[model samples]
Target chain A: MTVLDIQNLTVQFGGLKAVNGLNLQVQQGELRCLLGPNGAGKSTTLDLICGKTRATSGRILFDGADITNLAEYRRARHGIGRKFQVPSVFKELTVIENIEIARSRRPGLLAALTTFRTPLRGRVKEVLDRVALTDHIDSKAGNLSHGQTQWLEIAMLLAQDSKLILMDEPTAGMTIQETLKTAEIFNSLRGEHTIIVVEHDMQFVRQVAQRVTVMNQGSVLAEGTIAEIEADARVKAVYLGH
Target chain B: MNRTNHYDFLGYVAFAIIILLGVPFLLGFDGFELNTFARYLALAMVAMALALSWGTAGLLNLGQAATFGIGSYVMAMHLKLAASTGNPGGMPDFMGWTNVEALPWFWQPFQSLSVTLLAGLLLPAAVAGLMAIFMFRGRITGVFVAIITLAFMVALQLVFIEEQRFTGGQNGLTGLAPLELPGWTVDTYSLPFYYLVAGCLIVALLVGMLVVRSKVGLVLRAIREDAARLRYLGYDVAAYETFVFCLSAAIAGWAGMLYTLVLEFASPTYMSVSFSLAIVIWCAVGGRESLVWASVGAILVNLAEGRLSDMFVEGWLLILGLLFIFFVIFLPRGLYGLAVAAMDRLRRSPRTEPPVPVKEG
Candidate 1:
């Protein structure tokens, strides 16, 4: 089934079309990579999907339901999660506390007050182990290294039980080993959750992308398997700068 | 609760014991001293209210005194009516003195103590809710919230002062009668009355601590650190902000009601900008990060103000101003930071060597 279907998605910032007349679709549990150079509107597409930015003309459907104008948090509750290029985690809270909040069954004022006895310790432990951050569970999130912070954000998304995850350059500042570790994590999540990754690292994409969508100048230039995309003359000329 | 919260609980217990039993019995506090301490406790309640909204939730509400004053006036109105119930004329003395022949229609509802208490708590919360709907719903926060609240408070002060016939004008609500309970009438100046004030403070502290250590606190701190991120986490940022804002206002209102009983009056000055600022100062001085310290800071600051003003008369303002500046400059974390650091040092002193030994060549 189609998890995310974007129709004629157009975003205009005063005559400069960041994402113009774009159309894309992702199947459930499919790992798709969005590839482009600078100014390709890849990030803007993610923003539009997550309701962070309003489109000039578009419709977004998640799991066959129209979510075009849903508020960001509502979309999040509907199982849409995004990881920015920069890691954003609650810096002051401990790692377990951070995951516990996201893992809460009912995250609201009254539940928070009365249900203090159940701390989500078991769920937090499982997420911490998944991210290989079991030792840092009690440490403040701010004390973690850059790579660890990124992993913790991924753990947060996992704890959120997001059905679809949008990642923007998840390995932007990682060491090669850290990048490979992240690729392994994403590879492991392929069939369980739908994933759309926008990345500049071709090597990382080669490792995990089942299908690649190449965008340029605010529109999809090519969409195919990795081999088919690499052989496309238009993609090579527009994105590869051939 | 974890280790830190466990320690905080112990600290609260110690504070409760000290105030309830130690001060009057061991410290030998007389009626006057206890009454003064009771007044300080009331102010501390206001400071803790600020700590919840400003320190925890990252909202700097500069108009807190508006809510506090509202609570005070609501209770004072009830007390005035209670005192005047048996008189030949049903009207309070202020209504007669101001030459008002009849009780205003609005003052009729406060005749019931339960209604008065509910209004005393809910009125400020309702006002805060309206303000929150306007400010937070529109995503107004930080300095703008501060400015709007301060302006709101100043406006309320003017309205209270201008409406002379109803609000008692500049003289304010004075000559209030003793609050009558079911069987025992509360003597405002007595030891039991002081204990009642202390008990309120203890309850407020316990509730505040529970909130600060709960998942609510975690989310509030997250909102403080990064509200936008919290929004993306499927949490309604505005709702949480509004909830904390109204909750804080309710607490301030509750404190204001007790403050009226302690002082035996309510004045327009209670809602003034300076009074609101003083509450903020107390929170900052004690430690906005910790509720216990914030309340202690309020009491300590007020105690210092009383003693210092008595000694320095003319120079007290100058001295306090210098100390505030010093605290702002050198101790940005406030007194709570100092306590945390000292505790950390004490804990580390015993662990002189690493648990795992290194093998030397």
Candidate 2:
């Protein structure tokens, strides 16, 4: 089933058209990769979906609901989690505390306030384990390494319990081995939730994302399997570099 | 082990509480008016509330005094009216001069102690709630929030001063009676009043402590640290801000009602910008994150003023300004922040150095 439906979406800022007439859809629990070079509206796509940026004209349907105008928190409660390009975990909070905030944010206010209503602690542990961050659960998030911060951000998204997560460049500053371990974590979470990831790394895109969308100049250049998109003439002409 | 980073600090607070409680009995009586101490405790109520909202939540509300003043004046107006009808206390002179044959309709309900108590909390809370809705929902934050509220405080104070016939002008209402608790009339100005203030301080602290220790406190901290990330995480940053703003003001208002009983009058000075700034300084000196420290900061700073005024009266404020700078630079976390840091270092150093079971106790 289609988990996200973007139709005739456009975003304009003053005189600049950041996004124009983009149409796309993702399947349930699907890992869709959006690839583009610099200034290709890759970040803008996530912004529009997450309701952080305004849409000049568009219809964004999330799980059969029209969330075009829904604010981030309302959209979050309906299961849309977001991660920025830079690591955005709670720095002053511990690794576990950061997850606790995420876990609390995704639920209803009363549910979030009352601990006995749900086993938030165990669920937090589960997410920490998935990201291989269980050992540093009590450590402050600010003290983490660059690669570890990325994993902590992922762990935070998992704690929110949102079915669809929007991640911006999950492995931007990671070493090759760290990227492989991140891929393992992403692969492990495949069937349980949908993830719309934006990354410029071609190899990482090919490693995990089943289907890929290539955007260029505020529009889609190609949308198909990773191999098909990597081979497209238009993709190579605009994004892959001549 | 969690190492009790939270409780290690509480140990000092527990010691302080014991001293505060035992002081009255230990000294026997030092000509200290019980009524004034009660009043101090009531003011502490406002201090505790200020700590939670501004210190922990990172909201700079320059109009907290405005909220407290509103509650105080409203409660005072009611008390003044009650004295007019067969009460032994002299009716407020302003009422007699205004040549008012009867009390205004709104002031009628405040005559009842139960009703006055209810209005004391609700009226200011309602006003604060409405103001917070307009500000927070509009995404107004930081200096804007502080400035707009400061403007409101100044404007409200002006309104109270100018509408002299109603609020008794700048002179304020005096000759007011005290709150009559169950089986006891609180007229005497002894430790009974001090105990009353102490009781209020305890309740307000308990409530503030509950708020700061909850999951709500975590969200508040997160909002202060980075609100944009909070929005992306699917949390309503504005709503949380509004909730804390209103909650803080409500507590401040509660404190003000008790404060009126202590001072026996409410005036425009209650809502002055200087008062708001003083609260901020108190929180800064005590510790912003720890509510208990904020209270300690408020009381200790005021106590310092008393001693300094007796000795170097003229240079006290100058010394205070220097103290403020020192706390901001060297003690950025304030007193509580410093204590928290020291505890963390103490907890961490054990494993780093030799690791011989780490005699934590």
Candidate 3:
């Protein structure tokens, strides 16, 4: 039940190897947290898996399919969804319209032209309810608060029905209460969806991560349960600033 | 539909009434006045067309006049052929003057009115589709698209002017015969021709409105906002961009054809950079966000230009330039945004309370 398998993944930017010889595997319905200091190539690895960055040499097998050379949209079609550091949503469109786009079965131009707006009743309502954004469904996405905008992006991923969700710093720039709520939402999604989160806040990571993978200088330094990684001397010296 | 869309639909209806009924009633049947208005209406279609890509898809196509000129030349070629049926060698006067013995192979198909009409629409779309595929597939966006499109327009204009024998060069295709239908002829300076232009404008506007209200339009707006975000959401951003670009190009071409009919000629001037830029200005002044408002902007600007030029003569161009600057500085969203703000104020004045949230289970 491996949902994602990366083997010897490497991406070099000119003289720098941003992500080199990275290998990782995630099981279905597993909530894995990726931990690293700045410039540890955590984001680069995610980009490679999601087809945003082409690997210099490696294979990314998602759901048993080798998708190393697939386009970004093709990777997304294969159920890979990514949430960036900044909240990204259509600012001018209503919340309902944004969800409708993500929930669209056929995102082609011809299909979109013929698809009616009124028929998006069930799944749209369900995802909105899950994100607790049902009340603000008619408001413009730009008008949403920062925390709300982040939740709306999560709601969009839910509406997209993505099998594997890749989130980078989901709790960044949030108050304590909002972070706790986001942690709660992640916990709720753990058993039904496979998620890989790259987070800086250790407390947020402890709340949601079933297992931790620590990366440094372009490769995985260690992988273990949270308690095990905290006691590792190498992790302490490189990442925890001991 | 939501409240905003409902308001938008009402706006379209009011616009239709103004163009179809109000203007005709005001102008009466004076051929000169009607012809001028008809030309303005046709030009409005190009403005709306530009708004589709520039406003919705975030593609600023500065070479829109290339497609427009293609459409004009196609229609003019047909009319030129139709008018030369009795001339020596049965070819256009320009061709005969240029010492061409027979009609060129490319111009032969234009002899058939059906072919000419279809070509007028399809040629522009196809050309635009090709350019869009090239640019969008390469992930080119924003100002780069504008520069490339502007360059192509200048190149196309040069081709038309330099190829004197084929495209009628600087003089363009003139002395076009009246369009002949089953039992009637379309005289350019007549009521029927004016109605023809108006009817075409209405249909074009309806088509533009339909595009803006569909899910495709929703995605396009998203593309405009953040194309990279849409791409990561399992949508081919380039495909959507290309679709809208081609649609806009086809509409611009249609406008060009109507313009040729209104003015009785197709010239290299139609493909000039200034003409394409003027279309963009009209769209910007009308509020590029709303198609109807963009058309209104074109008509209003043209009307002002016509009147002011007559009154001030030497200084009218300066006045127009200053007015454009004022609109760009004060009303960045154009008149539509202004109207929307005004309406929002009026709606909130009486209620004084925030709207109640409709809870759903």
True contacts kept of each: 0.53, 0.41, 0.66
lDDT of each: 0.86, 0.77, 0.89
Candidate number with greatest lDDT: 3
Q: Rank the candidates by DockQ, best first.
A: 3, 1, 2
Each prediction's DockQ against the real complex: 0.51, 0.46, 0.54
TM-score of each: 0.96, 0.93, 0.96
Q: How does model 1 fare in lDDT?
A: 0.86
**lDDT digits (tens) for residues B101-136 of candidate 1:** 788889999988889889988999999999999998
Model 3 chain A: worst 10 consecutive residues (lDDT sum): A114-123
Clashing residue pairs in candidate 3, if any? Answer: none
Interface RMSD for candidate 1 relative to the native interface: 5.9
lDDT of 1 by residue, A117-179 (tens): 344457677778888888767678887877788888989988887888999999998888888
Q: In model 2, what is the error at residue B109, expressed in angstroms?
A: 1.8
Clashes of 2: 1
